[model samples]
Target: MHVLVLGAAAGGGFPQWNCNCPNCHRARRGSVHHWPRTQSSIALSADGKRWLLCNASPDIRAQLHANPALWPSELRGSGIHGVLLVDAQIDHVTGLLSLREGCPLDVWCTPNVHSDLTSGFPLFPMLDHWGGLRWQPIELSDERTVTEFAIPFLTDISLTAFALHSNAPPYSPRRGTPSCGDNLGLFIVNRQTGQSLCYAPGLGQPTPLAMRFLAAADVVMVDGTLWTDDEMQTLGVGSATGQQMGHLALDGPNGMMALLDPLPKRTRRIVTHINNTNPILDDQSQAASALKAARIDIAYDGMQLTL
Candidate 1:
């Protein structure tokens, strides 16, 4: 199994165009310690012949250019087989528009997300003119497994969705209630080696069910959207807490750091979907030191893991 980190920064990417926070300021000046990053996205491939994108970031074009493995092999032929969306967030699903190049593509998501894309955003009908969109639903079971879904173009790998706490995207009218299929963390297992990976770039809290799924994985990549609950408000970036925006902070008494501390040491714990305002973006910051001490890795673009 090969998992490639196409982009690790959260929504707007590091050094967003309009903002100039301290971290973003340093990154724009090309500081050695603060490198720029794209929005959150990953590519999963078992044999390197075919790739499945976890989420289509707005930076998809740049990300695809940076990674040659996803390039076209023949005339109008692409190595990318399908896309699996974890949520309907704009940053996560906006890149689908870039993919509409008269080539058929398969998209997998939960029923709720599918509805939002079709009715709320109306992105589905718009993409139909280019090529075709084959929407596949990834259903969850009472056993805590997303069953009956596999990469149609790849073998020896199975996909599952673990429920997480998340709200509907801000644009959706049906934003009042959250459901099991509203948002999800993905589990991709290599049936041949029993090596598995769990990805949760949008997290709320460490529920028992979420913990159990994380405990069972060999590699875990989770949300690192904010270093503290009040990071955005403190930096004057936004008024909402990290949780209020559908992300769990990395520090504090009930933050991700403490929740992850109890997991098995053997699991490789990496943090992705980092917000630019987070102090952890600065390697010299105390937050970075603390993260290093806790044996957690901050994911960066182009990082690769093989199992």
Candidate 2:
């Protein structure tokens, strides 16, 4: 399986337009240590030809422009077979609009997220006027059971969805009840090679349920939204901690780093959906070094891995 890091920054991206925080400022001033990143999203391919998008981030157009593999052919066909949404956040779903240039699209998500998109945000009605859009509901089950779904032309791949703690989107009518399928995580397994991967860019917690899923995969990419719980407040970016914003911090005794430390050494662990205010973006920072020593990776746009 081939995985592409289309974009690595959270909602607003690195050096967010309205943000003048230290990190964003450094990136704007072209500081070598502070490179810019687009909002979070990833692309996965089983045969290296047809691909499935993890999330259609707002930066999808730019991200696609930078990736030649995702470019359309002369016959006007896109390599993207479908999109799997983990949630219905604006940053995650807005890019679907950009894809409405006449091609049919298949979108897979949980029922609540599907409802939020069709009703709360009403994306389906608008996009339908442009082209065909199929909304498929993914079934969630226990970590031990692999919920199955098939990607067109990738018969050798099996896709599954797992329940995650959903803080729900701010616009969601169904808030607080994670069991409503407001959020989810995906596990992609190669039926041919037996290699598998897990992706959860919208995690609220690395619960035991999440851990069980991670344990079964060879690669796990999860939320890396903040460095510490109070990072946004200290940086004057926002009043909410990472947890409050439906993310897990990278540091602290109860943080994702410590929680993920016990995973098998062979399991490749990486972090994504990072906020612009996090200091870990700086390669020279102690936080980055600590993560490296702990065998964890900080994702960057355009990075790729073969699992």
Candidate 3:
């Protein structure tokens, strides 16, 4: 499997237009320690000929243009097979609108996420006139049973989605009361190699099931949205703590670092979906040094991994 990090920053991205935080400021001024990143998203391919986009970042247009591999071979076409969305965050789903350029879009998402977009956001409805949108609901089992699904048009790749602890989108009626399909922990496997990847880009608190998947996978690309629980509050950028925004901060005794400390060394760990406020964006910062000491890699745009 070929995994490409299309975009690696959190919503608003690094050097957010409206933000002048120290990190974003440095990034804007071309500091070598900081590099600009787009909103979070990735593209995967079992066979390099065709690709599956995991999440559609708001910057998908630029992301696609930046990568020649994703360019269309013919005069008017796309190499992208389809999209598999983990959730219905604005940064994740709004890119669908940008793709309504006379080409039908095939999308897969949890039914609850579909409902939120179809109702409150109405993005699916609004996109029907142009190019048309195909909705492939990711079936969830009752009693919280996790099921494996083989996405159509992709070979030797399968996905198993487990329930994750995270808040629903604000537009959703089930915002405060999360359901089975509210958020997901995706375990993507390469059937041929038996190597797996556990991806949880938005995790508030850890569950036994999530921990098990993380420990078992060959590579774990977990959330690194904030460095401390009170990062947002201390920075005076946002009133909510990292936990309040459905992110498990990497610091503290009960943080994600401690959770993965006991995992086997063979299980490569990487962090993605980083926020602009997170000091780890600065490679020379203490947070980045700590991440390196812990043997965890920080994701950046265009980073690629093969399994």
| Model 3 per-residue lDDT tens digits across residues 1-307 | 9998999999999989999889999999999999999999998888775888888889999999988888889897676888888888898888888778834888988898889889999988998888677888887533367688987766888888877888888788987787878888789999999999998898778888888888889999989999998987888898988877788999889887887788899999999999999999999999999999999999999999898
Q: How many collisions per candidate?
A: 0, 0, 0
- Residue pairs in candidate 1 whose N, alpha carbon or C atoms collide under 3 angstroms: none
Off by over 4 Å in 2: 143-145
Tens digit per residue, CA lDDT, model 1, 152-189: 77688887787788677988775657777878988779
User: Model-by-model lDDT, in order?
Assistant: 0.87, 0.86, 0.87
Q: Once model 2 is optimally superposed onto the true structure by TM-score, how far is the C-alpha of residue 208 displaced, in angstroms? A: 2.4
| Runs in model 1 lying further than 4 Å from the true structure | 143-148
Residue 254 lDDT, candidate 2, scale 0-100: 82
Lowest-scoring 10 consecutive residues by lDDT in candidate 3?
Answer: 138-147
